[model samples]
Target: MTLADTAAELRHLHDAPELLQVVNVWDVVSARAIAALPETRAIATASHSIAATFGYPDGEQIPVDLMLDMVGRIASAVDVPVSADLEAGYGDPGETVRRAIGLGIAGANLEDELKPLGEAVAAVEAAMAAADAEGVPLALNARTDAFLRGRDRPRATNIADAVERGRAYLEAGATCVFVPGNFGEDVIAELVAGIGDRRVSLIGLPDIPAPARLRELGVARLSYGPYTQRVMLGALQDLASDLYGGGVLPRDIRQLN
Candidate 1:
């Protein structure tokens, strides 16, 4: 599909009847593998996983140019629409998002680690302007880290604060509000209600409710984040450990094919 078509498809996926299931990828190989899946509608990148793959720490430590190159490669390798995890927009939300859009990225996840609400809203607006300049709508998932960082605070306060941020982001032209680390059904339902019509994106948790249940609670999308990539890396580590332990190879090695 053309970049404009893919961008439109990605934007539509959020409002589709079924919850968008995103298996985030970090590299060309992972992106291609997931893009081949019949169940995968769109490809999303995980910033932490991408940074780790490039031997850099997470939290936007990876150089912006390198990250954009990786994203461009993944987008070029896949037929599916690609959305990038542009962590904190690498300190320049507008230009960063403009570059991603130029590389054919259909969407992006930008986190706000409790920045002043005005600053967060401006960042979203900047990204929107960039996408507008490209004449394509970017599905901007404005993430708020309030819940993740305020676990010690009162739950209601965190939820309320998140709602406040979500509303501001949505009003600032965000395509959705992503409140990662809030997987509890009750809390999710409340957050969804508090945010009203805008979509809510959730992260996969160990105790996360089933997909059907999450849909019932009104979640628009589910993301595995860096967890999916970590699982594959963990298995690779185990294989390497056994390979160096002795001359004997593991008997149950599974082929990608």
Candidate 2:
């Protein structure tokens, strides 16, 4: 599909009756493996996983150019739409997104990082504006750090904060508001209600409600952040341990790429 078409499809997927489940990929091999699946409608890149792959830490520690290079490679390798995790926008949300579009990225996650509401809204505006100037829909998943940063605040307060920030982002042209944290089903319901049906995105944290339950709760999107890479690494460790103990290597491994 053309970049424009892919972007529109990604935005449309947010309102789909079925929830959008994204298996985050960090590199070309992983991207290809997931893209080859019949059920993969789109792909999302985990910023943390990408950073770790390049020997950088998360939280935008990786240079924007380097991150874009990796995401570009993934985009070239996959046929489906690609949404990237641009954590906190690397302090330059608009320019970052513009360059990403140039690389054929269809969507992206721009984090608010609990910034002041006005500033956060401005970042969303900048990103969406850049996408507009480029004539791409760019499903901007504006994220709020309320719950992630407000672990100690009262539950009600955090929920209220998320709702406030989420509404503001939507008004600022965000395609969806990502409120990532481990919360009770009631909190999730409240978020969906406050944010709007099928307009709230979430991280698939361990032990959280299953995708079926999240879909039932009206979540538009769910993607594991760095957990995909973590699980893959854990498997590698297990294989190495077994090999060291004289266990035979399996010969039935299928070529994923």
Candidate 3:
């Protein structure tokens, strides 16, 4: 599909009845694996995972050019729609959004990172304008770090802050509001209620309810983020350790050239 078509499909997935479950990928291999899944609808890139693959730490440590290139490669390798995790829009939200769209990405996540609400709002506005000029209707999932940063605050206050930032971002042209770190079913419900009609994306948490339950709670999207990558890497480590201990390698490993 063309970039516009894929973007439209991704945007529709956000508002679809079933929760959009994204198994975030960091590279071409992972992207293809996810794309090959019959249950996978779209592919989202994890910025943290990508940074690690490049030997950089998370928090926008990866250079914007390399990040864009990696995302482009993943998009090229898969037929499914690809959404990029463009952290803090790489300090230039508008240009970053434009480049993402230009690279055939269907959507992107832009985190606010505890910035002043107004500044984040402006960034969203600028991104929307850039996408409009490019004639690509990109799905921009504006992420608020309120819950992540407000662990010490009262629950009520944290939820309130997240909802306020979420609503403002949605009004500023965000396709969805991602509020990570508050995974309880009740808090998730509150976020859904607080956002009111805007799609809400949440990161997966251990104690959090299942995707089915989250869908029932009105969550529009769920993502594994860097956890998926971490799990895969951990498995790789275990495999290497076992091999070093003279354990037999799996048949798949033997087949590798």
Candidate 4:
């Protein structure tokens, strides 16, 4: 399907029965391979993986030009809707929306803790306005970083403030609100309850809960962040080490090739 068509389809998938299982793809090849899977319906990119692929850290190390190039390449290579993990939207809200839509990306993630809560919400609102101007429904997943740092930290100490910021993001035209880093089942349940019926999408960290359990908790989406890519790289390193030691390859090695 065309990118525009794919975006529309993804919007529809939000209402489907099963929770959206989003796999993070770092480049064109991985994006194509994952989208080729029968069960895969959409593609998401991990900022960390993307940075690592380019030999950089996750923080705004990569240039916007390079980042957008990677995004466009992935979008062109896959048939499913593509959502990018745009860290801090790369800047102000207007630029974020314009750049994302210009590249034909269906959605993006904007984080709150990267900036003051009020500025983050304002940025999201500006992005939403830009998306509207483009005539494409951009699914802005507003991320709250408070939970990632732990409740003992100053950020998580104020749950009410986080919830209020989340609500503000939703009001600014975000299709989903993502709170990463918190893992307690009860904590997650409370977040889901607080956000209640806002058409807001909640994404759970991979290792926290089983997919089935997360689904039961009313999570609309789930992602592994850089975990899968890290596993793949780690396995590759081990395989290389074993080969250097003159170890025989596993019987399934041929299948991998």
Candidate 5:
């Protein structure tokens, strides 16, 4: 399928109740590999991985154009739905919507924690308006960082604020809500129960609570951010060291050669 076709399919799938597994791809090669998987239906880009590929940190170092280009390349290589981690919506919700639509992306991850909660809500509202104007249903996954960073901090203050921010984000037109960070079963259950019947999407790491468990807890989608890339990098380093240290290359090397 073409990228546009995949986008359409993804938009349709967003409404379904079944869990969608979105694997994060760093480059064209990894994107292609994930696309080849029979069970894979959609792809997500990890900002950290993308920045690392360009020798930059994940702290908004790379320009928006560069990130969009990388996303376009990955989208072109795969026939599956491609959703990008548009960190903070690359500034300016309207412009971000336009750029993503131009790149043939079905959806994007938007966060409501860039600034004060009020500002974040406004940003999401602007993004939704932009997407509506573009005539493309951009699945905006509103992310909250509370559970990921503040759970152990001033527990009461953080949890309360997170729930409030998440509610505001939903009201601002977020199709899904993602609470990242290490969350315990009770927390996860509370979030799932709290969001209750709102078109919210929850995403968690594979290493955390099991994917199946998250699904049972009402998570709409599961994504393994940069875990796969990290694993791959480790394997490559080990293999290269073995080859240079008098170890024979595996049979797979012959196939590539």
Candidate 6:
């Protein structure tokens, strides 16, 4: 598919009757591995995972160009649509997503970092405007950090704030509102109701409701942030330990990529 077609496909997937589960990839190899799967419809890049692969810590610590270079390579290496986590847009939300479109990124997640609502909404607008200029649908997942960073506040407050921000972002032309962190069925229902069914996205954080439950709650999408890479690294560590003890390799290794 052309980049625009893939972007439209991504948007359609989010609104599909089934829940859209995207495995986060950090590089061309990982992206290809997931994209090669018969059941995989899309790939979302994790900023933290990509940053770690480049020896940088999470946050916007990695140089924006370096980060975009990796994401662009991954997008180019895959046939499925690629969605990237462009953390806080590296200080320029508009230009960042604009460059992403040029690199063939079909979708992106831009966090608000719990900024003032007006500022967050403006960021979403800027990204949408960039997408408009590029003429790609660019499934913009406007992420709100309210629940992730608002633990000190009341739980109700967090939900309300997230819902409000989610609505504002949607109005600003975000395809979906990503609300990461652990949430139960009731809270999920509230978010879905307040933000609009299939408009609230979630993360695969530990102890959150399973995918089946999330689907029941009307979630649009679910994605792991850095957990996918972390889990693979843990397996690698285990393999190294076995090799150091003269153990043989696993018998089921396949040519995934």
| Backbone atom clashes (below 3 Å) for every candidate | 0, 0, 0, 1, 3, 0
lDDT of 2 by residue, 101-205 (tens): 999899999999899999999999999999999999999999999998999999999999999999999999999999999876899999999999999999987
> Model 1 off-target regions past 4 Å?
244-257
RMSD of 4: 2.4
TM-scores, one per candidate: 0.94, 0.98, 0.96, 0.90, 0.89, 0.98
lDDT of 3 by residue, 49-139 (tens): 9999999999998899999999999999989889899999988999999998888898999999889988989999999899889887888
For every candidate in turn, the CA RMSD to the true structure comes to: 1.8, 0.8, 1.6, 2.4, 2.5, 0.9
- Candidate 3 Cα RMSD after full superposition onto the native fold (Å): 1.6
Model 5 CA deviation exceeding 4 Å by range: 1-8, 149-152, 197-207, 253-257
Q: Quick one: ranking by TM-score, best first?
A: 2, 6, 3, 1, 4, 5
Candidate 2 to truth, TM: 0.98
Query: Candidate 5 residues 1-257, lDDT tens each?
Result: 54445555775665566677788888998998888889988889988799889988885678888988999898777777888888787667678767877788878887765378888888888888877787776777788777655656776565566677778887887777777766567766766666643344555554457767766767677777777789889999998999899999776543211
State, as a TM-score between 0 and 1, how close model 5 is to the true structure: 0.89
Model 1, span 174-248: residue lDDT tens: 878999884567788889999864388888887678888877777788899999988998988997888798756
What lDDT tens digits, residue by residue, belong to model 6 across residues 19-104?
Answer: 99999999989998898889999999999999999999999999999999999999889889999999999999999999999999
Q: Rank the candidates by lDDT, best first.
A: 2, 6, 3, 1, 5, 4
Model 5 has a clash total of 3
- Candidate 4 has what TM-score? 0.90
Any runs in candidate 6 off by more than 4 Å, and if so which? none
Superposition TM-score, candidate 1 onto the true structure:
0.94
Compared with the true structure, all predictions reach lDDT values of 0.88, 0.94, 0.89, 0.75, 0.75, 0.93
* Model 4: how far residue 54 lies from native, Å: 1.1
